[model samples]
Target: MTHLDHITVGDQQVPVVTTTSLVIGTGSAGYNAAVRLAGFGAPDVVMAADKIRAGASRNAGSDKQTYYKLTLSGSEPDSVRSMAETLFSGGSMDGDNALAEAALSARCFYHLIEAGVPFPANHSGEFVGYKTDHDPRQRATSVGPFTSKSMVESLESKVRRLGIPVIGNCRLVDVLVDDGNVRGALFLRTDVGAARSAATEEEIVETNVGEEPSPEPTGTLVEQLAKEPSRFLLVRATNVVMATGGPAGMYSDSVFPHGQWGGAGAALRNGARGHNLTEWQFGLASIKPRWNVSGTYMQVVPRFVSTDAEGGDEREFLSDVIDDPNLLASLVFLKGYQWPFDIRKARDGSSLVDLLVYRETVMRGRRVFLDFRSNPAGALDADQLDEQARVYLERAGVADLAGTTPIQRLRHMNEPSYQFYLGRNPGVDLEQDMLEIAVCAQHNNGGIAVDGWWHSSVVDGLFPVGEAAGAHGVYRPGGAALNSGQVGSTRAAQYIAAHRAEAPEGDGFDAVATDVFGRAATLLADAVARFEAGAEDNTGTLITDVTELMSRNAGLVRSRASVLEALEQVTQWLESYPETVVVDDSSRRSVNRLFLIHDILTSQYVYLHAMKDYLDHGGNSRGSVLYTDPDGDLPWPDQDLGLPEEFRFVLDAGALDGVTQEVDWNGAGEPVFTWRDVRPIPSDDDFFENVWRNFRTDRGVPARQS
Candidate 1:
């Protein structure tokens, strides 16, 4: 490979290089794969993102980041079959990937602990587990609110010890592909420019230092930002693993770190097959400093209240709308297990909490807040909380909090829940004030499609782990994303190692580089042309439009008319890309933002289109992506999927597998979605297995093959 751009590394110019395998995104998944590859002695490299904890895994935290695993050290006699059964349950969209994930979850969990992740465990040497989301077993555990962050910390330490080459502050902007095999990736070193930008920011006093600084430019008032200086390194790799997470920050109402768009477009542009792009997960969280307030936060059952701008009538809003106050309090307790908004629970009081919160914040004119200093109207009595809530409180040893203030109860219970916030440099005292909440796009259960081993089925030599891979369907078990990332990345690493020597690097290097270069050049030329033509900067406007559209049309609730209108607007923005103004001349931040716009638009194009198709093909509500036709009523008053008894609109999880969408780029690089039947991962209970084996034997295969 030739040197595209040069950068001084401690006064030495490091040229572009080649590696056997390249792992993009330095989050948990990417780092895990890189370390595993290094363990196998198959040379690999990692981009130590702008900051060690820049991506979603490191930055985002919640009441408790659940880490779901098997019985392991727990008292319950849980088996892999039982684990897989729970994994496929809960109306989570189908695929046999969950079965494989379940089979591998135990090993992955232990792997993290071995790598120095400090998960909570009992003195008897058993890792403690708790219930989360849609799990029937006590398979979830966490270390405060930083489970993902702790995993990242452990993985980073291991990577450093192994001496796997890390190009810190680099971004994998594009991948070089020839004959459908990934040749390498083009990475831009943004650290140098970032440091320069930071030095400029140091002159300002009112800046959030050490944080992902706001997208503030430091240039002359009249001059548009010049193309910020950068060092582009094109690494030629035989295998490329895109462990970057899903595109979560594309929407404004998101809990992900600012401007962190998962690099999905790099694969989409190469005509890679993307599955489940329509199935993103959303929930309630604090908006200012984004964080999920679930687990113990909800378990403590804080007072749900909202206030107007003037702050006159302090009201427990749920009591006003819901007829029964006891049911309202119980539903608040249920929010602990039912964190994500489930459509089937829409009418049921379980999911009504989310609807009322969203309604209070968005639909109604009020700012919703969860006050820990107080309790709900009738929460004084021990009988008010259901047996499940009391059981959890007893397990957490906070059962005595029946008559105490929510904060005092939380203090005796999960100290780290509040301590985690106070541990920040300029700490937050949750005891004093209420935490503002909003419905934000949290985890994405959708992304690039992969086979059982997590290798991209269409783009050979390309593996997508973590959120980058669409292994998750609809709703994930609370901490399953962490487990899935570990499992998927390890599988990707093992697959790459098994075939490392066989990868052909020299076969079509020139051809791959030519095409990648041409595409990049065309985009750059268009950008420059637009800048020269006095194009107005509509990137901000576009982001607002995209975020609001997704929030209103395709968010927690959806209607056909609203989605079609959103589609029309998104289409118009796509057509207006030529006239879009991107001020990159004087600022690299602007360039990054411009690139982010491109990435989001590309990913959203497929997402919005797939959603339209999903509703068109009689796809009803399941997880967060609820579809309501404007002309017709909801496919509701139905009961299935282990749903709460009070609600309607339960999507048939079994029927979901037969109705799936595949997004592929055409000759013009525009995505076209086609519906396909994906193989479903049936529950692997002992009885189901025997019957399935018998059925297979009845068909053709021998029973012993099972």
Candidate 2:
């Protein structure tokens, strides 16, 4: 049964929604959780979303977005243990989560397939696969550029069929906790319009200067409420599944969909432990349409160009770095497969292209673009191509077209990729104009800590799946994230179905809701008061500033000094956010913007703190980020590439690989950091009878072997 009650917030009455299970995203993981929960005898399940169809799962894609799974059609030897070992080998990954992900991968993949996500299969009815980055076996598959999108659509269809209610336009402001456990969540209903009609014009008065701030007058409360033109929604759920995606707003150079700032801030504020917060995945992406420019986009070998702020001063930047035309072209080709920047490959591999792009854009403050209209250094002759590049092109049937322009080869090789740009709004005619690019933040490898059953490490009945869960460690295979989201969500649903299917017992909710919403109201009131007193609205500016700060200091490149400085700045921003942040107007949009800024700042502070702590623990460059080593050699130091000293990084040669760093934001003071050994993969009884007996006894959800 769904109960709609009311709670008093200041003088306003906020609606309270009660449900058995609440899924806090409309992404693949969230929708799947809802579908699975409903299917597994859960009494009631509802979904809450910031915006329907407005997330990375729907908007983000690459040339051929991959989904990693166990090898299905190959003659090659493979097992659950082998797959788990491969995932765990990524370093810092917990062996048990890896094992769980590996064991359930096929079940989850087939679930997607059964739900109508059309993963390709051969005539023999075997799902074909390919090798992706960090994968030794051919365990990757794709339906197209929008694998996650397809998954979301299919799972959403299932959710709809199950009659699961999805409430959109709900921005999670806080996760309501009671006595250390999750009670529910507080949200600002963005769709509510002009609900504060009781306030009169006389009540909306400006205070005389910033005199000792008195208790808000009835009018002041109404006036603050009026600005929002919205209402608060208090949702009390037995279980809250947070699949709110990554902290996209944390980086200015991000490919995450616009307006999907993520709900991690809410979880973190509620004392959710963060695991591997320092592991982020960065890659090259087009800035305009915000899509990963991996695979065929790079294999075509488009000309790399740089320009001044006004788009003038056109120069071939890569040509300036590498004189060998074939080597330069080969590296670009390699970038197709080795898309994300790996530290091991930074010095003498495809990742050097990433560094050059960073140098031209971030370091030199020039705009970088892929000029598909022209060939790099007037390229010609497929015979002159490196063997790897030539053979790949020959197999792709683009070898003979290599002498032609990049666009021509792209069209002949992958027409869909060439047409993808033309299909975008304000589309780029790759045959004519240059496509601007950046070293974009694509995903976070770490987030809220969880156990084998995808339950939050600290909060009972709180599960963080998808990118929100810090399931991955230092590195992951391409498409592993998609699989991880599926498997993790499935596990959470199974556990909830068997154990926590009933509504939470409570009397603590009233107190918790009052405390949480009261705090939120004060923060909002402070913002409005600051705005009324002539404080300039820096909401947009602050977001840009924070993103820029993160991208610069805590992005793919890091140093002890830079991280410490950035962490200090974030700390200052957090301290002053309420008092200094000004809402442009009373519109719910503006109010939400203020809250978003705080959330972004809160996330940035936590992330930078994790980075600072990691560096403090003698962490060196690994995964997507490179920690600068003053003693290290620069890329092609023998050449005159004008590479900055900061680019000189020494890779951490597996010293800290066996351990993982976790951070806890206790909602005050400095975030505490802890390092722990990764949980080893479980070797449980494989005898069918023993497993079946435990499975049956435990209601189909076995206890965590670890």
Candidate 3:
């Protein structure tokens, strides 16, 4: 069944190229993995969609992107152990893997800085740090709004310098899984950005002519697209790295770029199990010109405004909902730390802003917004703020502007925050117009399950890193995503380099390529027939329906009834996929969309089913994993499943003391879950020893350490 010639995919003939290590995705994690493998002298081919800069890592903007690292200075008494404890305290699964990530965090962060990422260091050459979502220690630093961009640009430069190959405009379509092992992967090279919807995209800000654009990453597929249209290309490798970033576009209300469908569904279909798929982090974000409004968006005390559809009836909505003025101001300030929505926080009024915003947008069916030009009308008197909120402003050096306009405080606190809106959003003048907002899907704390070696649990030689590697529990620190990319990439690379000698050469390129080619061709041929037949495709509407399903049923707050209902609808959609057509262009964009939509359908099934099971088994209401009703704050029907009655499951820094969830598999081999233990931190054991042992086999020290 092996063939050396090119495979026919629609009108395009795609050639098969084989390599040793194939890295899927060219974002922060993928590029870092590619570069590290290259540094270890391992050949790697990185695959990307549209371009390397197309991921949230490169495109997503935050006020000052928090890059969480362990405190390098001895000023804070933090260690790998403390960081590990914090990671595990976020809740869900094992902490052993998280412990390893914590250990390598400092090294990887410093590595980025050395590689030319200009992390903002003060005049004294000291990289000062600030607080982020989940950290007591001041371990976060930033270089304005472009933290991931900086990391990626530096890594991209290093990648170019080392001549690592990165293939762009490719979407991972068919994974070469044979004999229970992943040997290679296949991608359809085409522009399927319109797969989800034809909603008009906003204009990206233009850089000055003299400013150099980000460097292009170079990679070889065996990617075989010659621009004739859609071509099926196969890349055979000794190992495949999954770094496709978060599952965006999965929700109707998401901050993720509209076209950001990724590898979660691809991995799941191929029997690659994921971790914490039911657990996610959702919060407020901008819509039209998609962006996450975090950090200073709330810190500067923007006025929470709402209005009718015609822009006539203006109302300061938060004032009507909340009675206590100081509590209102304090809740806004809490958003600086508790950015992601948690049902537990909502009950205590901490996450009320998110709930109120949700209520306004979805329930009341009114537009909600954050206007920086003014404070909440008649509510935000400087003397009216809680002493804590007032003092926080003073500490941030914006006390003088506390009594002034919100934009005035924003300018004093974060000048970049004021300037970020100069031209990006249409009609959005922070100095004038109110910024429309919603509780959008921010990040999935869930993704492909992997071992300590960063290898996929389901397949040998498959390494899942970055957001693809769901090591995070229910919640994580703000900038930990960037840190996780570096740490996981480094681990995956080190493991590959150190163990490549002993890895079983799973399958030859010819056999794997031939098999994958047939699979891709058949799928493509059938999909093309659908497009040609005009098979009842409601792709755009279907995508919108599914996203709306996630937003309404399975967003930050969820209940068993809503989730189960959503599952019913999703299952119906999956069953009648004939109703969904692959939107196409001459480039076989339709064919490509077929694969993407299928992946999404399966991913939805996995999330709903897993969540249902967890709720059935008495999964506690906590963090971003909401189960019980938020309205009555009703307790989940504990089906006699023993869990700590008092476990708050707070997803914050130095959060809840202890918890764990043991993982299992269904008879079909899909991942299953159950509660494990409430581990108390032992004071007697040496902190360093616990984490040190995590790096070793307990049999011996790793060669890198030696």
- Say which candidate scores most in TM-score: 2
In terms of TM-score, how similar is model 1 to the real structure?
0.84
The true-versus-predicted C-alpha distance at residue 492 of model 2, in Å, is 0.3
Off by over 4 Å in 2: 193-230, 637-641, 703-706
lDDT of 1 by residue, 1-706 (tens): 1112332433334334566777888788988998888776565454434334467887777777778888767567888767776766644344567777888888888889899999877898888787777788788888877778788878877877776655544555676777777887765555434234333321221212255432222222101112324344566777888977888756777777653568887788776788877777778787656677776678787888799967657788877665455566667778777778777666444776887777676666688888998777754554556778867777876676556777887878778878765654335578997777887788778788888778887878888999999787666778888888998888777767665534346768756665555554456557756766787545556666777777766677666676788778777766676456454444555545555666676667777777788777777777775565343332223423232222234454556744567778732545677776656675445577777877674432122111
Candidate 3, RMSD to the unseen true structure: 5.9
Q: Which candidate is the best by lDDT?
A: 2
Global CA lDDT computed for model 3: 0.69
lDDT of 2 by residue, 274-356 (tens): 99999999999998777899999899888998999999999998878787888888889999989999888887888999988
Pairwise TM-score winner, candidates 2 and 3: 2
* Candidate numbers, best lDDT first, in rank order: 2, 3, 1
Q: After superposition, how far is residue 335 of candidate 2 from its true place, in Å?
A: 0.3
Total residue pair clashes for candidate 1: 6
Each prediction's number of clashing residue pairs: 6, 1, 8
Question: What's the candidate order when arranged by decreasing TM-score?
Answer: 2, 3, 1
How high is the lDDT of residue 650 in model 3?
26
Instruction: State how far residue 434 of model 2 sits from its true place (Å).
Output: 0.8
Off by over 4 Å in 3: 1-13, 44-46, 191-230, 310-312, 400-403, 423-427, 501-520, 534-537, 578-582, 585-589, 630-706
